[model samples]
Target: MTQTCLVTGGAGFIGCAISDALTAAFDTVVAVDNLHPQIHKTGARPAALNERVELIVADVTEPGTWDEVLAKHRPDTVIHLAAETGTGQSLTEATRHAQVNVVGTTRMLDALAARGIVPQRIVLSSSRAVYGEGEWLDAQGKGHYPGQRSAQMLEQGQWDFPGLRSQPFRCAHTKPAPTSVYGATKLAQEHILSAWCLAFGTGLNILRLQNVYGPGQSLTNPYTGIVSLFARMAKAGKSIPLYEDGHMLRDFVFIDDVAAAIVAAATSDKSGILADIGTGDSLSIAQLASVIGDIYQAPPPHVTGQFRNGDVRHAACDVSATRDTLGWTPQVDAATGARRLCEWIDQRPEQLERL
Candidate 1:
C-alpha cells in the first residue's frame, strides 16, 4: 500500500518545506492551511512551494473540514504544524494563543479519533519556548533554573541573571518551566499528544524546535521571526530594535534542517521519541543582527534597555538525543543560513512590505 502523509500549515515556512520533503518520500502528500492573515496577507500560496503536493485551505480548529479530509484521504502519517507563535505577544494575548495552539491541537486529535483514523505516526511541531528560563550553570558549576526577572531589575538594565552574571554557562537538559503564555500553550500541546498517544497506543514524535529561520519566515509577525524582522527593518533603512542589551542567546536552526527532521520523524520507526531539534549552538541576538545586517547592509541594531515580560533569557538544547532518534544532524550554520534567507528576501522585495 502507498503511504500518504498530511501536513497542516503547509503554506507556511516550516510546513511548506516539510511538505516538499514528504512528497519525495511518500506516494501521496496533502497539505492543509487556513493561511492566517498575519503570515499571508494575500491568503495565497507561495510560488516557490512544490506544485506536486495537494493543498487545502482550512483551519485546524474547524472540525467540519478536518473530519471530511481525514475520512477522505485517510493519511498514513500526520504532521501537525499549524499553530500561533509569538512568545511576547502571547503574554498579552492569552485567549488567541490558547485557542489556536492548545484548543486547535486538541480538536485535531479529537477529530482523528472520532473518525477512527489512527495514523502510523503523529509528528508534533513544538517549540523551545516550553523551556522558559531553561537551564543555567552557576559560578560553582551547579545548574539552576532561575526565576522570573523582575521589572525593576530590567529597568535598572540588569540584563544578566544574578548567578549567571560572572561566568558563561551552557544549557543542560530541558526542564519545561514555561514563562510565557505561548510557552505554556506549547507545553499543553505536548501533554495532549502524550495523553492521546498513550491511550490509543499511537506512535508519537514531539519535536521541540528552537528558533527556526529561513526563506519563507513571516515578515509581518511583530513578536517573532527576528531574522525576517531584521530584513524588513533593514530594507526600510529603519534602525532595528534589540531588546535587553541584545545579549540574549538562541539556537537558530535553519528551516531546511527542521524540515528534514520532521520527515525523518514521520517515516522512521521512532515512537515515544521526544527530542529538541536544533544545532545545539547558542547565537546571541547582537551577533544575529550583525550577521543579517551584512547580508542586506542594514544598519546596526540599537541595543534597547527595554525588555518584554515573560521572555526567556536564553534558549539552546541538547540535540544528541535527536541525532540518536532520527539520525539527523544540523547541516547549515547560522551565518550561511542567514545569507540564504537574505537572497530569498531580495527576490521578493515586496515581502518587506508585510510589516
Candidate 2:
C-alpha cells in the first residue's frame, strides 16, 4: 500500500527540508505553497525544493484551495506549516495574520470534514510566541507568566520582568498567553486543530518551535529570521542593530534539527502530544550579534536600546519532554548553526542584492 503526505508551505525553508525527509517514509510527498513574493522573490518553485516531490502553487487561505488536491491525493498525513510569520509586522497587519493563520487553518479543517477525507494524522508548526513572556520566576522562586510589556515600560527602556526573573520555558509547564497577533493566530490554529482532531479521532502533534534559522532561510524577507537579517547586514559591512539593550534572550534552533523533529512527530505513533522544539538553551541577543559579527568579520553590532512592540524579553524552551516523546534532540549548537547560515548566505550573492 502506498502512503502519501501533504505538506502545506512545503516549498518553504523548513518545508523543503521536511519534504525531502518524507521521501524515505512516504510513497508520495505533495507540497502546496503560495510562493509569496517576500519569501520567494521569483514567486515560483524554489530550486532547493526536492525534485521528487510534487509542487502545487496555491494559497491556503483561499476558498476551494484544497478541493482538488484533497480529492486527488487523499494524503495519509498532513503537515500544516503555512501561515504568516512576522511578529512585528503582525501588529500592523493583524487581518492578514488572522486570515492566514487562524482562518486558513479552519479552511483546511472544513474542507477535510466536508469531503469526509480525514487524514490519519496532522502536524502543526506552531510558534513559541504563544508562550508570551513565557515562564518567569519571582524573588521567591515561584513561576509566573506575565502579560505583554506595556508601551510605557518599553519607552522607559525597561526590558526584564518588573519584579520577577525569566526561567527556561517548558512546553508542558508554560501557559499560552500570546502577546503578538501572530502568536494569537498560531494558538488559535492549535486550538482549532485540537478540537477537530479530537472529534474526528485524528492524531495531532503540535510542535512549538523556537527561533528557527539556518541555510535556505529567506535572506531577502526582512521579517523572516533575525539571523538572516544580521547576516545580510554584516555581509553588507553594515552595523547590525541590536534591540532592547541587546539583552533579549532567544533559543536559536537550526533548520535541519527542526525539520527532523517535525518528521519524527509526523511518523511517530504519538497522538495528542504537544512539545517544544529547540536547543533546550538560550543566548542573549548581544551574544548572538557578536557571534555573527565575528563570522562575517564585519563591524561590531551596535546596541540601539530600541524595542519592537509585541516582542518578548526572553524565550527558550525545555526540550526534555520533546526528546522523550519525539525521540529527537538538537544536534547543532548556536555558534556552529550561525556559521553554517553565514556560509550559505555568503555563497548566494544574488539574495544579498535585494537587501
- Best TM-score among the predictions, by candidate number: 2
What is the Cα-based TM-score of model 2? 0.98
| Model 1 lDDT, residue 279, Cα | 87
Candidate lDDT (C-alpha), each: 0.81, 0.90
Provide backbone clash counts, one per model.
Answer: 0, 0
Worst 10 residues of 2 by lDDT: 62-71
**RMSD (Cα, Å) of model 2:** 1.0
Candidate 2 ranges with C-alpha deviation above 4 Å? none
Instruction: Please provide TM-scores, in order, for all candidate models, with all chains considered together.
Output: 0.93, 0.98
Error of 2 at 240 (Å): 1.6
